[model samples]
Target: MTMSEGDLAVTELAFVRREQIAPLPPPAMTTGPLAWVRDNLLSSILNVILTVVMTALAVWVIYEILDFLIFTAVWSGADREACLASPAQPVVGACWPFVKERAAYFVYGSYPIPERWRVDIFFAMLATGIVWLLWLNAPRRDIGAFYFFVIVPIVSYILLTGWPLIGLEAVDTALWGGVLVTIVVAWAGIVVSLPVGIVLALGRRSRMTTVRTLSVIFIEFVRGVPLITVLFMASVMLPLFVPDQWSPDKLLRALVGIALFASAYMAEVVRAGLAAIPKGQFEGAQAVGLGYWQMMRFIVLPQALKITIPNIVNTYIGLFKDTTLVFIVGIFDLLKTVEVSRIDPKWATPVTSTTGYAVAAIFYFVFCYGMSCYARATEARLARSERR
Candidate 1:
């Protein structure tokens, strides 16, 4: 259609001007604690109700625990009678006096009074070495690692068992029990299993048929059996394989069983991590002319191990807790020590058993929680490094 000449004439252009750009604040509803409450606790009607219920329940539980553990608990007493409720003291709580009285026995078991200092020294040195290794800013981390991985274990063993060549009186392994034995078994399993697991994992993925087959068989066989069965076999059946004149210490046998059992599980965890690495990583290493071990060491393993830190720590925690199973083999670990201590007629109160177990639980929790926290920190650090 054509526009008529009379319809409309020339038009003038219109323009609008801005004085300044304004900055806007974030929504008040999406900041601070109130925002967290809105997003997490009160996101929906059901969430609000659940959060309220859980919070109230947690508060009640915490209060009850504190009341039992502290408010009405007897801290000073000689025996069970003092821990019990009487006309003079109607309130009854945890028999902490029993724990305090037998603290040494719980720690060192029957490992003679005079030799206790050796255990103490060993703990001090171990703590020092750990502090040095984990200090972050501490000097000579390589030296600290060497001391921990090499010298500390040797010195610790010598100190704990005593070196007659060095004029120190020997302590019998039979006398070792309680937390001392538990730490030994757990630490040994943790330290020994990692390398064994790595080797098994590598073998499982090896190019050679025999190596792969043997690795698979061992891993499957061990993983198929319950830990208790392995422990029983180590304690009972292992002696038959050795010469009559060559008897292995029961503790050593238990350590072997625990280490082997842990290694199988650890190998699976490591294998998962190795599998997660892209094939390109391996190809890249090969393209750079790196040999198998060298490629794994400098390229593959560091990444794989970092990825597996959480699983590795979980394995360590499981091994630590399983040390309690040594009780079945007549080795007095922390749990066994507590059990034995609670049976004493002198301290046998209604609360003694619970108190003893609570103490052991606290010890286990602290160690496990520490490992978990360390794993989180390490993961975060590695993530940040990768981002950079």
Candidate 2:
């Protein structure tokens, strides 16, 4: 029964070791969503406070949006008289009825009611072509080449100009108004500006001093001037430059101005892409015995353009929105359509401001959103191929 000091010492050491080796407190409970959240949002008092503030702000925004859109609209709609109460006492929610009434005009402009099917067919073909282009795994270059080089121009011109080889009546350009005009201007600008931009960018970097100097002067000069001034020049000064008997259509003049302005901007964007390319790319081209044009077409430009597609798309989006400024030159684009709508005596209620603004906002949102989505898809496709 009696134990030695040695025995007691051994027993005490054994107990200490057991305590130290007790599974290490279950490894501190790592590797779960809760742990991740705690690490990210609740790790410190400051983080917790930030999280709470953001959540509250988000909830408040959602509640306000719901109340304004759903609740207010429901209240106003329950009493039809309340919606049309007065220009001063108009419903606080959206005037969707105004949109419903004039949406066709917004879509097709002043294109004849009887021949609206032409616009429909044109849009359908364009949509199909776009869908094919956006399918990254598809035979893009071939399909897109057809869409770009052949189909698009023919379909768009026929629908817009209505030169009517197919029993459809001709629609005068003068009568065109609304979102169609916006699209017409943007599309024309995009197509015309791209080739012009490519040339200008190449010229700016060309070995020929004359070409380089001229490109620099033109790009900088156009970019330096405001779009409004360009539109003004297209409308006013362009006539003076032309033969006295040769007056171009107003829409054509606006298109030329928009294309020129957009091309200048596009050239700068392309030039930035060109400059970002490594000198070694050019050297590699030469090492391959490729000539200047071949080197640019095959090696340098492909890589440079891949890097700049996102930037190019952004520039296009800006150009698309800027098409609205053609209104300054008396061209009726989407925004101008809204401006014109307000002058209608029947629709010219005190509510015209809200209605017109709401329509324009939606039109812009649709187009700009589409362009942004296209840019994202293009970026994703490029990323998958290990290109920026």
Candidate 3:
């Protein structure tokens, strides 16, 4: 098998094994991150144009926003005296000092000045519980559940609306306003509506004709009417529905209306998720001999609810914002608080529009944006898990 000197060897066979240096290949660009940007972001002529336009638009928007918030209004240079100056000679900028002066009102509303510490404690507990829940991989999972379902609610409720057992003075819901009212209404709506929504969704999917019909009628009836009308009915008609001897609190009445309205929308959202699930999943549950509740609790709902998380989050955001509509029912929420502040004789001026609106905008942005971010993160995590 020796190849004497017979073959000069084909192509570069000899050199292949030799330590001979070959010419380096010409450098070629790769479609890595940079190339990805060039393609998707700047691929076609139209895309390139769009990119340029968007970049310009973004820069222009930033410039204008900064100019308004910083330079033109002299927000950075405004002193305390300048800020608290009469509304007549307004700075035309954000009345941040006004917000600062009434920050307590914004947070706890007219809750007793001495009891504001309770608000602080409630917030601290809420924040801690939320953080604990987020750290689900911790060994304190069971503890976390207890804190969430039991401790947190009890603590928050007691702190917000005191208790005779704790020797604390009770604060009436009627005195609640500002962000406290917002939080109360939003949280109550979320808690109450979710279970109701689940029931309604189940009813809509039930085999029983009467239950299904009832669900459909309820959903359609609520969905067809505007929230304004629902609020009106709650304010005017809810009392009549109950016995005169058992009059519901105005806040409770509004809560019922909100819960009912929110549940109808949430039911639709959940129904969409339920519909997306395959029929085989149900049959599989049946084949396994899982009872209806067990099948739904373990098998069907987990998957359906996961699919519906985005929709459900959207519904939640809608409900949170819609709680503002309780103002129409004479229930003071965050928006209503601002509305009240705008009418203050001292603060009522041309700038009142700007100040009240700016404050409300900031609050709304915080809640809505936080919800959106949470949904995005949840969606991303679910996507990654699916991949794995």
Off by over 4 Å in 2: 1-70, 74-82, 85-91, 164-166, 243-245, 343-345, 348-352
lDDT of 2 by residue, 76-181 (tens): 2322333455667454555455556667877777778887777777667766776676666777568686886588878778776776568657888877878778
Candidate 3 lDDT: 0.79
**Which 10-residue span in candidate 1 carries the lowest summed lDDT?**
6-15
Instruction: List, residue by residue over 1-388, the lDDT tens digit for candidate 3.
Output: 7665546454336544557678985534454677778868888999999999999999999887665455544233223444444557444555555566566777777889998888888778877776787664766877986886688888888777789897889988888778877777787778777778989999999999999999999999999999889878987887788898887778877877888899999898888888999999999999989999999999988898899998899989988888888888777787887777767665544545566677788789898999899888988999999999
Q: What TM-score fits each model?
A: 0.92, 0.81, 0.84
Candidate 1: residue 374 lDDT (0-100): 85
Q: Evaluate all candidate structures by whole-model CA lDDT and list the values in order.
A: 0.91, 0.79, 0.79
Q: Which candidate is the best by lDDT?
A: 1
Q: Which portions of model 1 miss their true places by more than 4 Å? A: 1-25
How many clashes (backbone atoms < 3 Å, residues ≥3 apart in a chain or on different chains) does model 2 have? 0
lDDT of 2 at 351: 51
Backbone clashes in model 1, listed as residue pairs: none
